[model samples]
Target chain A: MDDKLPGTLPGSRRPGRGPRQAQEIYRATLELLGGGGYDALTVEAVAARSGVNKTTIYRWWPDKDALLGAAIVQSSLLRFDVPDTGTLRGDLSGLVHRLVGLMTGEATSGVVVAALAAVAGRPSLAWLAREFVTDRLAGERAVFDRAVERGELSGSVDPALVLDLLAGAVWSRVMLRQAPVPDDFADEVVKVVLEGCAVRA
Target chain B: MDDKLPGTLPGSRRPGRGPRQAQEIYRATLELLGGGGYDALTVEAVAARSGVNKTTIYRWWPDKDALLGAAIVQSSLLRFDVPDTGTLRGDLSGLVHRLVGLMTGEATSGVVVAALAAVAGRPSLAWLAREFVTDRLAGERAVFDRAVERGELSGSVDPALVLDLLAGAVWSRVMLRQAPVPDDFADEVVKVVLEGCAVRA
Candidate 1:
């Protein structure tokens, strides 16, 4: 299917000539944003780097913000596919591992973190946040909900909230720049939270 | 005592000397950050606004990064004090509310967000991040550890991991700018994770 196409990989490949052009512009876009922040991700520079005209990029993405957003999508910045390991602990651990890996990876994490950071204040990224996270959360939720249906979770627990809490911690860690994202963090998180660890009266 | 001082209530305070000057500089630091992100925030501007000298700020702090770090010290900028609520639900909710209030507040939130965005490549902010979060986490860890000691949490539960997972979700939500930090999020997080939605084996 067209869905399982190139350019969607972690390294970013191009599809149509237009898609390829977009990818090239996006490459320059990432370099600029990565080298600096949102401010330096200029259309002029991106065009120059891609060897394409500014008019061309503008026609595709409209503005610096749009170009950045498009570049993010085309660049394969976020991979939300939930890892399946069957057990709740395994599932959640897999989820956490995937996230921590994505966040801590050297090549892409910078731009990814920056995307969620200062420039995210721009109105343009707001919709992108919703679209990206919603879909991402939905994917994870399906995994959790399946666990619930299998009676791994209390039937009453909210899947979305569960994912929210899990993702929230990593986001906080990264946002605060507090400490390294531990590899076993996801495993321990699933173990403690899923199994229970509070004083019951 | 120098610690027992007036003009400490933020906006209404008058700038006098010593800590007051620091406060004024911090206040200006926040304002400049709001108007612009990390790049636009200059020590010179902070000095000018606070009616203090750049050398003075440098005397207290090594550089602008340190100055900015000082500005974000354990004051209202970041609330690390978490209470010992007996129940996990109450404890987490209390902590989450405190954090949400701090990170989502009008004045400090912007700086918090911007600082996070800029921290990625700076590397200088690493010390700031550790000093800021470690103490806060220590407080919460004590609370959770108490619960564990009292048989509130299972003996096997790792307090650090729980805290990380809990904080992660809240961080992601805030950084992603996806939704308002709901008051009940922490409570729900505690319940779903601790109680387990799956049918008990």
Candidate 2:
């Protein structure tokens, strides 16, 4: 019953406060980030564009960094929930499918690219990015933990490396735009990493 | 004897021009890119800082984009000469090693990251990045091609995807700074992509 209550939610807004206002703030934040990136983004601008009081934003987020972090979480940039299929292959395929969607999404991609540039300029933002990436990777790492327990994977396999290869492939393709992420991309990538690309004895 | 001429050199400076001046200009360009991102970079400033005439710069490169492209080439950003080791594994290891070095180098990484940010605002820079990446990938593809002929790789393997994974792993590690690129980082990455992480049947 406690889990059913919105107040008990980990990342949810205050129970009494309306979700609509927060939604507006999040949308405005994404728009500003997309248009100006992080350096140029301001709390006042978000307030003016979002029609929410600056005080309201401050109440939720103590500082601009906090605000940006919350906005990123609220935005669809990190919206994918990790899946837990029985097999390692199924689990990885699900993770890649969700990753491709987030990366290739037009609106989210702009904010992400902008965020990446911002990190180069501001060292503080690196902390935010690391935190976000760590959180996302942790969720994906669980699948490997399951595989190791089931003896599908060797005890020596590093989950972080697996995540890096899977996520990195999609990221490079998305950023380069050399080719579109095909329908079979997730499956092909998973198979290569799992089954090996090279023929061995 | 026909290929022995200085004029036919791969990375040679222009004939009759001193390498010192070219080095100064490239140095100035890199400094500007590091201090301020692409939008903030200008030919006049580079000319003033480099002590090279603005007219000279214009004569050589019609636009700033051209100047940047040349500077990137001259900056040792892509200095890795592709290796032609007999084994596909050896070739890929060499390629990744060079890639890791270029990306982790302080001066080059600064420019590369700034250029990535600049791409978000300026579409033309994206074209330059694509061209650079395509050239790099083509060289790596040759290594794969050699392996195919040697019966080391199946003809069905996709060279592009292989390059993507190899590059993506190093890139993610570099940008995130989760861990240093170890001495054997390249070999490990190539091995994983070549040999499955999961136990075989």
Candidate 3:
């Protein structure tokens, strides 16, 4: 997820600060989102709960959707970094596993889906969603780029498409609830996607 | 996609009926949706605009969501049936092309995304979205099954996974808008997926 918080205060938190105020604001946002899906969440509630002024929130986020987007990125997706296990399979599988872990969690899933709904038609929020996904994919793209460098993958391979295929499959399972994401599903997908499933024994 | 409307009244239109009233209802629903999105659409408004009694709409559809869901399915997804080409390549590409057509259209894309947002947190609407996807995949699954029977695919291949890969790729392009669904993107995806990207020439 994109780490650049909109209108972030750089180096503003002095050494005497007891705790980063942004952390408190994020916690309040997540709590409100969990308690009342997306509709009931408001900047006023966030301010009341976080003890931060509403103007500060607006100055940083510009809107509720932006605040929620930043909070979600900070809370959930920021945890995973790109994996480099020396093989495409290892790296891909690791990425999928990390995603599976997040999707399977109740709190994260609630926040994620609610956030998507909150941003559905609004152009700015939609752009934020696209940016978040793109930023998260950057890590996986690194793995693919490395594979290309090592000649494990063709230099012409579209890292974006590769990431889309892998991520989309998981999204279908988790968001659409068509099927469960089994422990081995990622490995199977990586194998088929990498090696082609058409030529079977 | 799913031809089965949840509570469709078949042959309910009598001989004296000049034009089907359901069409009017659906048109009004779409108009309201296009103007104000899912939040502004109401059965009462549909009734007022279409001149259909609110009681009648309620009789046919249990609630506003059911009405909107039915209207969306009727207006959009119902029109596209699955393609049956002689080969998996043809079938997959055809399916992707059909989806690209819908996603690229302004009206359909608006309705589709609005419907998803309307159903995001609600269990019943979520179920409807899941059902819609599952029903759509059934057609693609048929193509895969036929390929296996024709010895074009391995008998051990997972039909669900194949559908997931294809549909997921399209969903990524359309829903995530990460990349454009180039005219040849489907063909490229089919080739890579079928032949395996791992072993490049």
Best by DockQ: 2
lDDT: worst 10-residue window of model 2 chain B = B3-12
lDDT, residue A117, model 3:
61
For residues B1-201, write the lDDT of model 1, one tens digit per residue. Answer: 355422222222223344546677878887777668777889899988889988877666666776676666534555456777676667777777776665678866777666666565456666766655665666677777777676767667766566666666666676564577666676777676677544668
* Candidate 3 structure quality by residue, lDDT tens digits, B1-201: 544443332323223232357777887887787677777998899999999888887766766776666666555433587788898788878877877777667657766566656666555566566666665666567888888887888888887787677767776777765356677788988877887777464
**Model 1 per-residue lDDT at A75:** 62
* Candidate 3 chain A, poorest ten consecutive residues by summed lDDT: A9-18
Candidate 1 Cα outliers beyond 4 Å, as residue runs: A1-20, A51-53, A120-124, A154-156, A199-201, B1-20, B154-156
Root-mean-square deviation of Cα positions for candidate 2 versus the true structure, in angstroms? 4.8
Q: What is the C-alpha lDDT profile of model 3 across A21-93, one tens digit per residue?
A: 7778888898787677777889999999999999887766767776776676565433587788998889988
- Considering only N, C-alpha and C atoms within 3 Å, which residue pairs clash in candidate 2? none
Off by over 4 Å in 2: A1-23, A74-77, B1-24, B73-77
Query: Model 1: how far is A154 from its true place, Å?
Result: 4.7
User: Compared with the true structure, what per-residue lDDT tens digits does model 2 show for residues B58-113?
Assistant: 76666777777667654554457889989999999988887777676775777666
User: How many steric clashes between backbone atoms does each model show?
Assistant: 18, 0, 3
When just chain B is superposed on the true chain B, each candidate scores a TM-score of 0.78, 0.79, 0.79
Candidate 1 Cα deviation (angstroms), residue A53: 4.5
